[model samples]
Target: MNSCKVIDEVVNKGLCIGCGLCVSACGNNNLKMALNEHGFLEPQQVSGHCEGCKGACLSVCPFNSKPNNDISTETKLANIFINESKNHNTSIGKYINTYAGFSNEHRVNSSSGGIATYTLIELLARKEIEYVISVKETITTDSHYAYSISSTRDELLAGAKTRYYPVTLAGVFEKIKELDGKFGIVGVPCFIKSVRLAQKADPILETKIRFLVGIICGGVKSTFFTEYLASKAGVDVAEYRKPEFRLKDETSTASDYSFGCLDKDNNQKTIKMRMVGDMWGTGLFKSNACDFCDDVTVELADISLGDAWIEPYRSEGLGTNVIITRSILADDIIKKGIENNALTIDNLPISSLIESQRGGFNHRHNGLGFRIKKRRSEGLAVPPKRFEKDELSFLLKLIHLMRMKVRKKSLEIWKKTKSAEQFDKRMKPYLFLLSTLTKINHYYKWYSEPGAIKASLIRKKSKIFK
Candidate 1:
């Protein structure tokens, strides 16, 4: 197929995740990442630069399903770190060590645990890497953040917090080509996979990008997601500026942080995330590409980091990070930091790390299987996935289907109304149904567990006595 045709299949068919590897990997420079009408970055053809080509671009796409060229993240991990890693699992991929901790200095500034920020700082301090490529505030009328390269300590720290908004690596790839230095990139799983694919296709990228730092992502959101939240916080989308998606709430738990943004007048507006409701679970403005993804912890990254959502860590007002280190060098850096008292951390079982991101895994793995099967049954284009077709209970399947509907419809509804109130009014039924079904599923599982019947009987007996 021609380059245009290949990209059309991916983009038109809703399979493109917009990482921009295809643009960077193109020898003809035929593609560029552009913001779509829905406010998510998508690769658009530069012009009529048409040519019949082998699968150079799609070969690197994490969602590509073409034969031979369609490489799995598992295969990449096996080829690169299989012999070096101390353990391997289908859920989290290969790892040398797992830990949970926070950096005393960086935690306050970071979204969670501060480990990712600290690691990037350490890599720079040790002169192991000359620069760090990460997300930072861009503050345009249309966008609040984008991928940027950081050279100084303060720059990395400025890029510390998590950004759920969609960003593409196309521009940064050109920047990497222009600048000369060793670099470490931080991104979500699919973006990291794209970098790996691009590196395989481009020699310069392979040499320049020395480390991959991954952030555990549930799914990326379109600009509308933030706009919706900003609107709910009483800021107009046109007036929105300098968004802070995760503002720590000292009086509440780690996960109960607030969302803050600057209005047109430069006044800060803040709202507790809980007050905005659980939009994340509802999949509001989530990319269609996310429904097809299966990697939960960036299994292909050198080291993956995420919020520690279990137990004491979750209770801590300052966030905690659950980390999976795949490379020896990455693990050694953590160890050195611990020894120097720059970090306070403890080795955690890999299972605990997996539990911390259980919600992500459930959606990416089980939900992915169901989505793939449904897409195939409808003769729709399904992206290549690491998981096989999974059989979910009828209720679960319906809930999953509802979530897909919610994600798909949210953008259209928001665009039509442009009013958060109208959007919420239209989506109430879907949310109510999804919430009710999810509660049923949760209760059913709770009651079906082993010893649950005995426990329930004891509770009943105690209630009668009381």
Candidate 2:
């Protein structure tokens, strides 16, 4: 096992899990991951110390990173579709819930509604999976890395939310060979795409990974942002250990106080901040990888879930999912669950869901591929779809900027909320962009203008990325 190979796998595959175990294990400076290409977070070499230890990295690797199988069949997707939807927005087959939700551990602790955690839990509870090869922060450090934690229902309850610091994909890479039962994975769009790429490179993953749960994301940042929030809170910084971002006790309003964290001795450290409604890429502390991301939502995942952040459907202090089950199995499970009253939902159209997700905006990355294709089809090395302030592109950049700015405020709000419902009133306005524009409407959140212009010119030189 070459260190370069391992590092490349970790970087490109990006299951890093953010454990920092490899950093400790690497006797040589040969290994490190410091803001690489696309920059959602990847591992790199400080020099080449990790260059020689193939097996060593594996020894310390957490997630059993093995490629499973290709479920890219219409039959599978169709089956899930048929099974989960109960005529309206859910699958009807053997479901126990209308939609999958677990206000359990991961949700209350998560950035969005904690749906990803619940999805994994549902899989485990149903015996559809053996262990989960997802990323988690180890007890020892704030850094995250992948770990193939076995689920007994109990373990699933333990990790149901989001970890902002680091997520290690390498751990999964190390332990994959030992597992036998089907597994599941949850990640932001880029990570899901990377996992898809990994499946292409190594087929074993497709066989084992029964579910690829995707979360719509803006991007991820370093632990620095959490630190930033904590610093503003007037807490004793030196005593910090592990920090949980949100804490709630079922109250509503400013005095209710939604977010908090924990330190080394399990002391609940509560801090407060301002609020906003958006989740994912607001770009304040997000990695550069987000800018170049081609997928706003990983279309390939078995199931894609995200906050329904648009209009009439949004509950101020709580969370609702704009769920799209890629296949029928997922659909069926959800459908049955709802009919059985194990789940509850508000029927939503795909358009409503998309609006909630703030779709329609284009960016350099969005136009990039089409730019390349347009160039290729037109007989050019690179297309010349340079950014323009014309109606379309101008609006695209505007929306992107607004999304970022709102999310920056949102991180502050999230740190203070715990209501499964009752979000700030300003957060639930539909048609945020259109509402600001001459009156359009959205599913949730207030809309204004796509006002910022940091790299407004980048849209101009997109073809010259090389």
Candidate 3:
């Protein structure tokens, strides 16, 4: 089918990730990406006339068809330049090496270890790539962030931290088509996958996009997330100007979120993240498409980077990255950076790297089948997934259902919330539902299984007594 079919099935079905590949692939400026009432970035047809052109847009869309192919299929299809796999994990696909590291200069100010920023800068410095595309704060709006092209180290640094908001490649793809040069792009798994699909359809993209740097994603938040935070922080959503998430706090254990806007007196007002309520865990503003995805490590990327959420690294206030390199070029760059003292790195077991994002993996992979089944039971359409259907334990099924319930109710409650206190009051029951599931999962894991407590103690003692 054509772009129209794609809109009817994926976009209308709420399965669109808003990557904007379809808009670019349409090739006639027939489609444009814009924010919907739900604050999701979606495509709308600008021209009603059908050019009767061949539909390349449908083939390039990642969500157009069921992604039922195995991990090996993705690796084999995407990793055309790499042959051998050095390490493998069920959740984190083929990798040449895994490491924990940080950029000496950027660690403190970055959201994580700053490896992603450093790697992009290194590529630019060596002239390996002429330009890099990433996300940076929007100068004109109080909206969170937007896609930008960075040719200099300072420009790259400006986009360094994790944005945690929805960004699209419609503009970036237009620029790539116009400009002629080697390029590197940083994005989440689905975005990278869409780029690969576009590259297969267009030869110029295949040649110009020399590198793909993926960021491990839990999911992306919508503009509603920012608005919700603004409201909680006492800033009027209508008056809110600009917002930043994961603001660096050298003294605090976790990063804070903040926003700036002019008050009635025309004085600039700023609000910190704490007042906005718990953005994480609640999963209130997460895109629906994210729930259907299973690629937590961005397996299709040349190199994937994320926070080292496991012990030792997690305790360090400066932050650290769990890096998985799939391309020889990425491995070499990281190796050289370590050699020159630009980065501090150490080889870590693939297991440790997987452990760093255990929660994300469990939810995205293991819990996905149940979610799919739930949708199907309701006669709802679902995008195809690689995960196989398996019977979940009763408690696990209940937990999954509870999470969905909480997610749905939280969105409704957010719109009606008049004050932070009311927001918290209404959200308490839903949050309690999540907390109860967490406790049940923990208790079931340790108490229900024979010797589970003993095994846990041994693991803890081994770490401490070592």
Candidate 4:
């Protein structure tokens, strides 16, 4: 690894695909991708995770757009689909024939499925909700965060794609007064809690809200990852203008990506950045904030969406989704839409979802694995005495580390192939060195601070006391 590698700027308001290449790269046990509030897996920083490695993680990030302050969003299309689905379609308001890429695409490009996003878009089109209460990208001096708030279709679509940043409903609650009227939302479990709190705080919202959609995220990132990326892309952090993650794509996979921005010269620059097996789970492309998160399934929301990590669909390009309807009203809308030929429907299970999607908190967060390790350390768990003859642990650790490095290196090579070959070649080594010293909170670093830590222990303690 180069010692003088360049580090990217902090990313505040976007998603991380959670691929885990960085974890593979680090010979030292400093980096890991863990679950966040929403359930999706993300990069985390263990105290000693980074062995002064830089290029491995930073080079692999696909979302880091040029940071800009002049960013903005507004509403787009708003047309109703009366009855435009098929026999397989289940609900009128639940699916959209108007949109080419909707209707149970859950078998295709999504996490759990395509239903939740479709649901949100349908409500917006029907004008049932004036704005989708969601997280829009935010720019802070240090980095950008996907601050929670209300969003129009244009805004939501613009903000689409995974943003590995921490999102909270508290911010969205503050923005709700301006939206005022029937509204929908897309968020994680914690965000749903915040929304419930907001509704409790205001009686009108209880009436005004028409729908709620939650994403099954593993964790969120800090703004530091964003800034670090921008800096590496030859974009100046001080003169940064705006940042956009997952700049729209017909292809849902992370591999087919294009970056866009107006450079310091006010000239627009777009870059095609794509690779194989690109998903948010890559540890190389995540935020440190993820490790602290505890929720993954989005229990508080009426509906939740994610990718269906199943075989046939997972093989079909990367831009698909999965959806789960938990609320009666949500189920009604989807069901009605399907019956009216406005959408399609399907019955599914939680396990099927976990296996198909990337890292969510349910089975993906390493919760089970962590428990196993903890038990093993405590002597509550043990290897077979016959197997104890060999220290398989060291071999397993070595394999994991080496694999991560190979993946990280492969990604770096892929990126340079698209950019200036010579320039990127020279820069990669330097950037590798820089990425070592350069640490970010969201995409690459994992945190252990007690301030934002989530705990089941607290709940258990309260129950025990009771």
Using TM-score, give the best candidate's number. 1
Q: What TM-score against the true fold does each predicted structure earn?
A: 0.94, 0.61, 0.89, 0.49
lDDT of each: 0.82, 0.48, 0.76, 0.43
Ranking by TM-score: 1, 3, 2, 4
User: What TM-score should be assigned to candidate 3?
Assistant: 0.89
**Candidate 1's residue-wise lDDT over 136-185, tens digit each?**
88856556788898999988888999987888887787788788789999
Worst 10 residues of 3 by lDDT: 65-74
Which ranges in model 2 have alpha carbons more than 4 Å from their true place? Answer: 1-41, 46-114, 142-148, 236-238, 248-259, 263-267, 273-282, 359-466
Model 2 agreement with the true structure over 318-423: per-residue lDDT tens digits: 4556666656766665666566654555666554554564541344334344334433465533212223223434444455545445544444443444221322
**Number of clashing residue pairs, candidate 2:** 100
Clash count per candidate: 0, 100, 3, 117
Judged by whole-model lDDT over C-alpha atoms, candidate 4 comes out at 0.43
Best by lDDT: 1
Off by over 4 Å in 4: 1-117, 124-128, 137-162, 165-172, 175-182, 197-210, 231-234, 247-255, 258-260, 266-289, 339-350, 361-365, 368-466
Instruction: Kindly indicate the candidate among 2 and 3 with the higher lDDT.
Output: 3
- Mind sharing the TM-score for model 4? 0.49
Cα distance off (Å), candidate 1, residue 393: 0.8
